[model samples]
Target: MYSKNVPSGFPRGFLWGGATAANQVEGAWNIAGKGISTAEVVKRSTNRKDFTMNQITKQSLTAAINDSSTTTYPKRRGVDFYHHYKEDIKLFAEMGFKAYRLSIAWTRIFPNGDEAEPNEQGLLFYDHAFETCCKYGIEPVVTISHYEMPLGLTLKNNGWAARETINEYTKFTKVLFERYRGIVKYWLTFNEINAAVWGFNGTGALDDDLPNDQKMQLRYQALHHQFIASALAVLQCHKLDPEAKIGCMLARMQTYAKTPAPLDVRAAQLQDQLNLFFTDVQVRGEYPNYMNRYFYDNGIELKFAADDEEILAKGKVDYLSFSYYMSTVTADDNNITKATGNFALGEANPYLTSSEWGWQIDPVGLRIALNELWDRYQIPLFIVENGLGAVDELTPDRKIHDDYRIDYLRKHIIQMKEAIQDGVELIGYTTWGPIDLISASTSEMAKRYGFIYVDQDDEGRGSLTRIRKDSFYWFKKVIASNGREV
Candidate 1:
């Protein structure tokens, strides 16, 4: 049966825009009073097996230094948004951007990671950047800590493990709340809280590998700390400016059962349980019953003090925001079933096509994901990341004919509008990337997902110029007509 159609247009004052992270887009890795982040220390490929927990010994850093002559900065000079904020903001303004979502680099503010005083230069950079967005009348949505934190903090204090991270994160939040009080009102406490459970495992939190048991324990512990930290940040926001809206962000990928069998149903249910376990604590201030049981069964006891629950309860989020790129399909299995090709992990939907990197393209799955989240949480959701990643060819006229991207967005926006019509209180929709920038999962530049094409490549060689793709014009019309134009 066909679902009901949306009305001709979106709600009044709907937000239509794009999202970027500081580490992915901000290229001044060490400039403007910034210290070395974990990203800077990364020399080998992240997709490799060792990427999860390979520690940066002195030997690795020294080897990096010795190889500096031969090694070009992998993340350095990433589209140069630090130096081109005016031009980029101008591009976003051209799209009638209702909001431009970006993150503040924590290291930029706390250079050594423990300094009580924030560097004036780091804070000033965002001050100017926010002013630029304001100049273009684009609302700025700021993420407190994206995937990249100061490497020094992780090496010494152990990222998100020690209680000290909560304090450090709180200080960072306090600085932003005090400084950008009225200029920016929308704040996400952490980039992808669910990722902590996954173990910087994919595109966020701590990107280290460990034994299966330790991985689960560390992930849960990190999440516990972040939940408390987010709650505290929310409380702090209310204290500083009661009108500010604070939300917890998660990397929410929808999962489906591969078939109608009971095991598939159970697999899909477990997937949902895994994703919502993070939100349940943040929104409801208590872990779900099944999740508690699972931890007990796995002997994964999370470390928490008496007051942590109180903090979470007091600081329940105002809204829920998430990034949706693709959906995965799963079937239950106790062992790796290499022969059947269906026993474990995601088997991308055969019915759907995939991106260059093999992420399935299912726009309707986006609607399914949205409705599922809304049904469970009941909080207003912001679709913070949904777009196509493709390989682009810069034409002779410096234009990218990216109709595939437009079609991808067009279908997703259609699903979003349908969800909104079906009583989903969606706050906004910002595609994965507004302009081309670095990829978070693969740390590659070729994974382009932008309405604005950035002139750069994986090797980091280009003019750093910006050109509007066809989707840029398409999105402008969609925003102008309140999505009815699509």
Candidate 2:
């Protein structure tokens, strides 16, 4: 348990940073030898409407591919970060960022995932990007594949479901490792690798039209391929630059039993086990014993090469990083009310409040998640993404008063300090998005999560101006004081 009277601050040299994905932030999707990615095919909703997983069905995706209109696909014009990266990095520096978490759009490096040669233009863009980060003394934490893969891979190879895609991913990772070897030291093999299992839409590797059993089989197979690719990437990174710290990213979803009944407790435990399956493979380098019965019951048989287990055993991650937006509850009874979070659904906790998007707010859950992860993995943990996404209004005086956002962050930071005091080896905390960008689930700008506000809207109409909200200064002071002032 965590106590507030410990009278301590964050560890020395703790990384204070922000995170963003290329597909959500960097526009210029078709330029500089960049091929169309799966993200490019996701249509942006016109109204501020929430999207269900059915929105990206196979038929709709095919239509989006043939549409040839970038207007419908807002990810094609993601905040224009490709052209405005220097400006944006400058803003991050102004906020006194010690690190920046971003992704390398795989399509940008390899116009097609299985290409023989790399794109010089795309490589040079990241070269300049990393150099700029180094210029400001901000360490770059790069995710090799952050829900952005070349569309060609899915169409031709069925994404990671096909074993060949692993080779292609290895090629991509090698290019990144060799190119940014010395400049970037922190690497995340896959963003939310577990999303491939439950939230297949985010992985962009699943076709919604597939049969239920087939979908499950393909999803698990694809997850297996990613595990192998991640492991191989870890080995390659060490060989190229032994100092590089490569970690696996999981969408950590903490759950609680609705009642003290043994059935409810067992249900919640099973749900948590399913959620932790990805981390178990990546961090432990082997499948858990429980998975044997799971595979038998589901009739899911994963294909493996002769050396797959050996490869996995040798390529375990150096650390564990994850995103925690909310916690949930479960029960054997169906009467419990449900709530939504970052592509996850569970019973609502009556005691906790929710955000505009109906995501339950639980600052103490963050501390609980930290302790749980540390106790399980016994490795250094990184809070790579945690924030509150709400509607922000720019006042008449051109200032945004986001005291609510500040309060949300302050409470979470307090819990984070307590988690550290409780003996969790925490590396750092980077808020989901330091500047507003496209929402991953809804593709709307209105669902903003940033201390620095980007002037944009659902229809993609704004001056593309960047403004610092009240929380921005508050965060700056917190970082300056090393989490003492928060």
Candidate 3:
């Protein structure tokens, strides 16, 4: 079956590309028509015992976490993509990128988060950026809102907690759709919409470290708001230009188990319900039975406004896009592998090595995820983010030997090709952090994910130089051969 399923190559017009988010890549943190974002308040700490580093970490371990509320310091230049986009896009074009996936900063458009009018300066910045990509025959795929929301709106209205957030989000999307309708044909309403289940902090939820009843409330409320907003944005795109295609981007987290035990099986099922269920509603226009039952049993009823259901039905997305990184093993009581002293939550994989940041490497899991997403939605799938995050060292001669990243991408591409041959209607493959950006989860400079490396560090000091790694040339060959050469 595996041999018969291998594809000779991708379809002729299949898009080959890479992706990045505005907040992570486009530093200028508060410059050039950009407004303050929650990321602005978010800070990263190296020493776990530093009390001054509040928003990014709360523990006494020497690691970083996003504790944004108390971290008063601003984010340092996050790769400075805002000013260096021309040079970066040129490199992408040189690599033969057919499509480039990026997001528009909402704060840049509506500085204070929401306004009756958008800042022309903000719109003009993208106008040039997208037009530049078009000039080189690279189609720009835009995510209207990434992880960073306007700090003004989030802090004032509690972000997606209030219904007003839907209105605010609509305001931003309405203008973007109308303005960039022709130049940017592909659109994602939100980046990782289901990530709210993790929470408001960097983990995309309120408390990833510990769970509480109130966290569930916050999660549900935030999801409800985003669902409504996404539905409305889809409708807006269609109304503004019926030819436009809008998608809801999600984090397609692949969950597995240390062993095929009953509890491990149940744990995996629960995660599918928790993660994929959110996208199910947006793509299928209805919630799955397991998700509905869980919500009811947990006493977490989702409230929708009067026109919410109608809006959702009318504005159903044209496709589904997701980011697949690592796979996780789970078990009910963390007792699945007692003899090996391994726990359900996490343990070193005996069969596979991990990224420096600890995400499990499983290229085959990508193919499995592709099939699951396609089987469930029956809609086209666009891979919005997929890549290897590693520590890249720039030699004195300015050369980066990133064969590890090349290997990571090569294996993933092989699985993606296999998935396509299996009849999954995949649109494009965009490796996350195409040009190294700050890590969203760890908030570190060293955790890199890019074919083109950015010279920077965690302490916010570096030459801000860009150098193509070995993966850059390998990826170029992949794009040129359409998966046959690489």
The candidate maximizing TM-score is 2
Worst 10 residues of 2 by lDDT: 46-55
The best candidate by lDDT is 2
Which candidate would rank higher by TM-score, 2 or 3?
Answer: 2
Candidates in order have lDDT scores of: 0.77, 0.87, 0.76
lDDT of 2 by residue, 317-362 (tens): 9999999888999998778788888756789999899998888889
Q: Write candidate 3's Cα lDDT for 351-389 as tens digits.
A: 766766556788998999999999988999998888887
TM-score of each: 0.91, 0.96, 0.89
Candidate 2 root-mean-square deviation in Å: 2.3
Q: Clashing pairs in model 2? A: none
Clashes of each: 4, 0, 10
- Segments in model 2 whose C-alpha atoms lie over 4 Å from true places: 1-7, 46-55, 199-203
* RMSD (Cα, Å) of model 1: 3.7
Q: Rate residue 179 of model 1 by lDDT.
A: 94
TM-score between model 1 and native = 0.91
Residue 307 lDDT (model 3): 80
